[model samples]
Target: MKQLSLNDIQAAAARLRGKAVVTPLLSNIELNRRAEAEIYIKPENLQHIGAFKFRGAYNRLSQFSEQQRQAGAVAFSSGNHAQGVALAAKMLGMPATIVMPKDAPAVKVAGTKSLGAEIRFYDRWQESREEIAQDISEQTGKVVVPAYDDLDIMAGQGTCGLECVEQLQEMGMTAEVFLCPVGGGGLIAGLSTAVKALVPSVKVLGVEPDLFDDHLHSKKAGSRQKIEGTPESICDALLAPMPGKLTWSVNSRTVDEFLSVTDAEVEEAVRFAFRYLKLVVEPGGAVALAALLSG
Candidate 1:
């Protein structure tokens, strides 16, 4: 059982200094009016690789020894994490191989390839991406960088929460709630850990795609639960099959509740971000906001 402390998150913040992008906490009066609450959004879309995954990817890979760096790294993701690992490896001057679903968005595939990572496509419906990554690791002797299941990765993701808390304090305000998007639960797990430690009273909420509500089910069951079948949804990044074991350990304790958003709601949220917030966001990136706006 690996327990994460605020110190771990702080240490990650220290490591990410001058490395990770410090995305802003943006709010719109229109959004506040609709949600009936002063909602602040941390838009990781501005982060490198166009997602928050880069923070964890770089945090985990940067700690590799000289020998490990030389040997290279491997990882599996639908899209965002693949791009994150590829870009991080490129920045660190290490070779990378990414196992990605065949149906992963084309733009993300091109982004990963542009970073010079070797891409292996798998059938998400028929093949196990974890097994593929393990086989690649065994054969190539590359370090397997799991997207969300590692301690360093979670700690790295926690930096997002750390920044949010600090930014709020700087604004002379305290948040009453935090809504985070969840796939395999890395972001929310680390985020909840930081928020719970810094502001104990804030309600930490996890939002998932309605078609893929594994987190909601897992919370109700008091254990990790897997979604069956490949349900179609516009939120491709949120199609993760199950909650990560280590991520669940932290999420079960720190997360206060879980919410699910529909594809239509996510589309609306994306439009809102562009029209009002003046930011471009993907469907998965907007689900947490979607939950709030839909209410």
Candidate 2:
């Protein structure tokens, strides 16, 4: 698998200019006081489709050639990436079809449908989303837009890190440590690549649901780790069974450490964000903050 570079993220930043929202780095006074460190939160739950998935979606979909764009695109995601691809395809005037698990959140399903994408549901345990997407691509001639495995997708996710660094720099602050939720490791891989490149001394950490700690295990083993058993978590978006091959290649080199948080911790973080920060964070989206608070 090919590894992503800082330049890849830089180019992605350029592509996302004026397209993706530069989400704010939020700070809570009470939390800061308690933590004894300035905790700057990149509230990506405020991002388009209510997560950072839009960055990678737009970056990949926008790069499709006229023919491919016209032919359309197919993707699979539990939720956030489905909405991301759907919305991006809609904005770019391309048809989109998403393969989603039947048990995905209703709000997320409605969100994706609202963006005018065709939805296909499957039993996540009994079926392979990638195969479904590929089947659809073959039948319709639409390009398969991978949720996190593609280079462009990884690079696009990296833009979040770039924006974080820029936002911090604007505040005359430098990150001592940076944390982000990890699923297939795409976001962390991209974000770590950019954060490490721009702020070399800053530690980049990935947070995962304790039940689905493939990235964490992989980091410990110094290699890819295929998780066993049926993993369950409220953080649906962070339940990817293992890191993407492409993403792991980058993450293994760039990220400093992996942290795993329990569902209860994530719930607490979500409640805290709502009560104090006035921010609504999904279970997966709040894992990094959960780690920061509990770790």
Candidate 3:
């Protein structure tokens, strides 16, 4: 298990300065009244490409060498990561090729294409995205940018946690519990590492759709576990078949627990975000809030 230190997160934060959005932690009076705790929401849905993934993608992409940048890069994602990589590459003036599922949200696909990346679609159930990405990399000599399996990506994602802590302190508060959605576990793994180091008592929990609870099961089993059947979740961004080996290494040590929410609960949470919070969160991005609300 590779361990990510606090230094790594700080370095990532430094690198992301003036690049990534310092997403505000929003506090609603009604939300706090209902939760019985001071509930603050980190609205990454407003992030570049409408998700937190841009943090890691830009972090990783910016570090590419001049040669690597010229060769271009390839990534595999259903939606969020695709847009992340595409936008990051565009910002860096590098060509990007993204392998995405054919059924991915049209909005996301259009978002990626709008960023000047070439799109290659594959069947979600019938084809392996990794294989397709690998083939593209081999043929074009483009480097494959993994969505969640690499340490740099995890460190970049850790910037979110670092920001959360800084923002909380500025507001004269400390988080007792930090909830975040988990798919391949990079987001939670990075967040857990940073939060635990900054505030040891803060509990960092990973939330996932009930049908795609590989992280939940893996945490309980004390090993990385892959789902047996097709992951049938409405949260397209949270449907990784299993947690990444590297992400699991960090998550297994830093994350305190895991939570699972149903699709119905997620839909209601999305509605809640829209109706009350005036935020538009996709199904996957709402899972953590769903878990927090159901509690």
Candidate 4:
């Protein structure tokens, strides 16, 4: 496995300059007072497809050889990554096929289809998305766009951290810590790497639903730890079974700690964001904020 570096993230940022949205770091006076700390929200919800998944998707899809792009791309995701790849392929003028859970949010499924991608639904509990994507790629001879385990995908995600640092620097301020929701560990893994490189003292914290703390358990075990039984949460996007191998390699070193929030706490955070910050955050996206509110 290759190690990701600042250079790799910098390269991805260059590629995404005109293509990806530079989401803003928004602040709310009430939120600061409530948390008793200045909390800056890097709203990747403003990104294409309403998530940071677009950053990695566009970065990887746009790098494919012309022949590969024309042949098309295949990916598997419960929601966000599906829409990311679907929308990116459309922007790059390529065909896209996504393997998604039958129980995925209606809005996300509709969003992917809205981008003109073919959808393949599967049983989320009984089936393997990776296996389905592999079969599709073999049948169609299209490249598989991995959700987060790919080198390019992680590097692409690192661009978000790079932007956060630059955005704070421009305001003549420095962050004491950075918090992000952890699913397969892609976003936090890549973002933590970049943030640590730029500001060594800034602690990077990864948050997940208490029932789905794969990263937390993995950190304690010193290896990848898969969730054993059925665990449930309203944060559907944070339910990845385990941290990706590629992402864990970086996260093990870059992240300072993992924090777990209950489903009720996450729900409350979502409500708080809408009421106080006027931001409609998805449950998974609100876990980090939930942790802050917990204390």
Candidate 4 least-lDDT 10 residues:
227-236
lDDT tens string, model 1, 1-295? 6598889889888888888899999888999899887888998999998999999998899999999999899999988999999988999999999999998999999999999999999999999888999999999989999989998999999999999999999999999999999998999988999988999999999999998999899999999899897689999888887999999999998998999999999999999999998899999999998999898
Residue 221, candidate 1: C-alpha displacement in angstroms: 1.1
Which segments of model 3 are wrong by more than 4 Å?
none
Q: What are the per-model C-alpha RMSD values against the true structure?
A: 0.8, 1.0, 1.1, 0.9
Candidate 2 global TM-score: 0.98
lDDT of 2 by residue, 128-202 (tens): 998999999999999999989899999999999998898888889888998889999889888998999988999
Return model 4's CA RMSD, one decimal.
0.9
Q: For residues 8-55, could you state the per-residue lDDT of candidate 4 as single tens digits?
A: 899999999999999999999988998888889998888989999999
Estimated TM-score per prediction?
Answer: 0.98, 0.98, 0.98, 0.98
Give the lowest summed-lDDT range of ten residues in model 1: 1-10
Colliding residue pairs in candidate 4: none
lDDT of 3 at 43: 97
Q: Report how far residue 200 has shifted in candidate 2, in Å.
A: 1.2
Candidate 1 wrongly placed segments (more than 4 Å) = none
Residue pairs in candidate 2 whose N, alpha carbon or C atoms collide under 3 angstroms: none
Backbone clash count, each prediction separately: 0, 0, 0, 0
Question: How close to the true structure is residue 259 of candidate 3, measured as C-alpha lDDT?
Answer: 93
lDDT against true structure, model 2: 0.91
Across 73-131, the per-residue lDDT of candidate 3 in tens digits comes to 89999888899999899999999999999999999999999999999999988999999
